[model samples]
Target chain A: MEAGGRLTEDALIARYFAPLAGAGADALRDDAATLTPSPGHDLVLTADAIVAGVHYFPEDPPASIARKALGVNLSDLAAKGALPRGFLLTLALPPDWTEAWLEGLADGLREASEAFGCPLLGGDTVRAAGPALLGITALGEVPAGRMVRRPTAQAGDRICVTGTIGDAALGLALRLTPEAPWAVALTEAERAHLLDRYLHPRPRLALAPALRRFASAAMDVSDGLVGDLAKMLRGAGRGAGVSLAAIPLSPAAASAVAAAPGLLDTAFTGGDDYEILCTVPPGQLDAFRGEALEAGIAVAVIGSVEAEAGAPVFSTEDGAPRAFASGSFSHF
Target chain B: MEAGGRLTEDALIARYFAPLAGAGADALRDDAATLTPSPGHDLVLTADAIVAGVHYFPEDPPASIARKALGVNLSDLAAKGALPRGFLLTLALPPDWTEAWLEGLADGLREASEAFGCPLLGGDTVRAAGPALLGITALGEVPAGRMVRRPTAQAGDRICVTGTIGDAALGLALRLTPEAPWAVALTEAERAHLLDRYLHPRPRLALAPALRRFASAAMDVSDGLVGDLAKMLRGAGRGAGVSLAAIPLSPAAASAVAAAPGLLDTAFTGGDDYEILCTVPPGQLDAFRGEALEAGIAVAVIGSVEAEAGAPVFSTEDGAPRAFASGSFSHF
Candidate 1:
């Protein structure tokens, strides 16, 4: 980590960055990343920061950190119905890490960049006095008039979510308490699957075009189901009532919930789900799910938008409704 | 600084972010920052990170930190011959800072965003177990074929630089050694002027169009003259020899160098100049300067590019040449 040695800043950049010939832009050594605006398309840009100990475990693998950094920003673009085009990375490194750490991190980013069809355009690297921090800015492109927004939901729109929910939350809980009976009883493959989902959640970019075509309002579920839904409701000047029984859960998550009744609280409040949450009109729900399936994304009808402006209500199958102590994870 | 309280994460984002809207992007509050690219213009994007203690003083004002975060990225755009359009900010906050610090930082960003005519498009905030870190991704627009790059400089190009150099370095020296006789003798106005130059650097966006017309290769001097020039030379596959006496120094810097012979070394090696270092053809030098003066930017002919490929050399008044150090500052 010593900056003044055989490998100077310029030398390191030449060694690592110069060889990266990006597909969508000129190589990484340019002053700025250049992009030709496609005809009749608008661009989308979003940046997110992931700090050690706050966003992920301090001992998390470098690859996981890299994936999470790009994944979170891609999730934002997915919510906006923008196809992944490119990204810029800003890395703040601590003094203790070896060069291997950086190389591994960069390898992971390169994998994600190529997989998502987003080239690494430009970025900066700096040394810091504390835990490592990573910041990623993802750029995307969408048809000019088809971008979905959070404030356009209607009163009668049906709420839908993509993919299974609460898997990552359950995975995190297991990681936090590894010695617990449930954690110990899980098969190795199951543990790996859950951990991978938590570490490297794939952004649902394939569903973006269809969502733009059918959904009225859309967003990514970063801060859990009920909390982010409430945000969309507030933004659209409406409210929602979600059915608890209708909440989709993976088989592992269902079994965990059965074992621990309080697991629903964790399911409702845990962050980093990274699934798309949107509202489609009742008449278009079938079409929306049909298109989503064609795009290889699973879909579930979660609830319906309400006419009244108030807190989001979660109703049980037995007609009882109760509020949870916490709605989502908050970083202040 | 606490995670959950009156000024919670949601409340803070609502208070500061809801009112901060970008000019052309309507979905700033949605999942991503939507940008409608102007017709016939390509997009230019760049990202830079500033780490506390490494990039600035630990006690630096929040306003200065915020400005530097955006200013350095804008400096890159200035080098690319792109118009200032919009930017994204990602901040990693230390746990001990007060809410007032966040407010002051946002206020400073807002001030610069308005002044530069670049709106704050989108960003993320997160907690960190380290010093405050700021990452900025700046986006700009340029005509399809006009985005200047560093590989276009030829062997016979006349190396040029904009504005006075060494002031920011001298300012840093003054700040660090306030008790020195030379620093103590400075007038209040001079001291304030020097420090202001260090804190709030104005990116030369106005000169970009003119640079695109005249310069062959362009880049900002973030890493001292010798270091950054070497980078541009590497990009252009050329070599350069700079005349030490020809380097433009402010009057205060000249006095400081005269007072302390080692101040020359500080002036030459100190980073954070934020001025454009470019290469223009010998025949175009006069026209370049004329256009620069008309655009209200000072220009200086400091060196010339050589046909041979080797390390950059700095020649004194008497024509004695020596190899310059590679990097100015060390992150670790």
Candidate 2:
């Protein structure tokens, strides 16, 4: 609005962002948003930030990038069995930001916020150097003293995961190394599936109620399943013996790994999976599975907690030891 | 630690940040932090993001940057009459980051979290492209329906501000142009005063209780005195005629402006002045001033709401209308 080719800060917020605000945001005119929690509910808070060309490609669709910023944080809440309440966004735009790109981002946020039941509260935007970054802080609600935690698994709990693992990692590999045998051997449908997995995260929020009622310990499987599970178990002062052969995989992922077997490591070690990895007590496993099924989410039983206080064990169906337990270490 | 030169993400968090965790953070080992608000309170939330080489010098002390990331957001909470509850951090480190730098940042956060009574609840860290970014989402609490808002000022209200206005702006001017006449004319104490104001923010949290009781409308003067004041006035559907002579200035700022009269514009229109600008009804002005004195914070009355609705007026001591009213515009 100032005619210097850059939108004034107030005008930018009013034009592009103010419409996305939800209840208690005061239409983003106030310095802060006021949220009155329902009686007997506790707030669950989580924050995640993504950088252009680091977490997502600079050329990726603007809308998907916006969604991912909120989606990843929502996934953390889902893992904790908290229903999405609202989210705050902090974005730094490079000098060359386009109005169309901003519109697309707002469109994406509008759709995702509506779909996830999380509305936009309030946020701040600033001008920065290159490689723009977007951060989100999502708040959720759970009944008092009822949030499932990461380090509460017992020795007899069953290890379960929602949805398949390794698809996003395999998809990332396909995007980065098209000439590789695994990438080249895929059919159009398989390629589409893998790339879609890499681009979009379907956070299993539908199963939050079931997870809250049934799970002993849980976490989002963003960093490889082996490493995340091992970390969770280690925190609980216990360990688990998981069968690598039993790890769930999508049809497209199965086909790609079948074409080039070494990608099995990539599938088990790469990040951005965003699936829910949870533990259920042996007595609650059946009910958890039944509830997950009724919620239209898949749950797989792959292992059991060991009664020992040592590092976790990953093995093949033949009971041979595998060594990728800390393979995700490279990511950190 | 892992075998690689890079600290594993988990180890980095555990070593440097876990000790700062407050209640319900689960020692930073959980998916999310659970916050149970006190009964009959509304949570006020605000988010602010700062980028290296943009917000502060790339060589600025790491701890200060960490503090500013949280400090600016806390200033917003103070303006809304919210008391500190807790905060979430989202940080991205450039590939060349060092452990020493990370430790300094953690140390700063620890001190600030303790000093403000705002604890580190939980956070996420990731490796990213160059030019690191830090974001803080701070949550505070206020008695229900009692938050001070920016657009609630009524006609005939007396506009007031806490602390001096132009020190941070003049300090920034000296930092960016030490050879300027104003910078060169300043004494060592004056220069130090300016630099400190620019480098750190003293959020006026002590005045929040009085503000909740007295202010009709409130907001943080972050952009600049004139522009920010005009913006606040316009938001409330009112206008004000403010006297430039009535604006409070530190002795250092007074000396700098005397040396180079033109820098007066910079003093009035520069960014990062984190003082509170509030409006009080005529009847409550004396009580508000008395309470502010009891709290040991300075309060200055600079202007009065105008009867007619139009762009606010800024005037010099000679009663001639001066026009730097929208001068902070270039910042956006």
* Best lDDT among the predictions, by candidate number: 2
lDDT, candidate 1, A284-326, per-residue tens: 9889899999999999987889888877888999878968788
Badly placed stretches (over 4 Å) of model 1 are A1-6, A17-21, B1-6, B25-27, B322-327, B330-332
- Model 2 lDDT tens row, A176-232: 998887788889999998888888888889888999999999999888887788789
Q: Report the C-alpha lDDT of model 2 over B85-147, residue by residue, as the tens digit.
A: 999888888878999999999998898888888999987886766678888999999999888
Cα shift from native, residue B332, model 2 (Å):
4.5
Cα displacement (angstroms), candidate 2, residue A30, comes to 1.4
> Given candidate 1, what's the lDDT at residue B26?
59
Model 1: DockQ against the native? 0.75
Provide interface RMSD per model, one decimal.
Answer: 1.6, 1.7
TM-score of each: 0.96, 0.98
Q: Return the lDDT, model 1, position A35.
A: 79
Candidate 2 CAPRI grade: medium
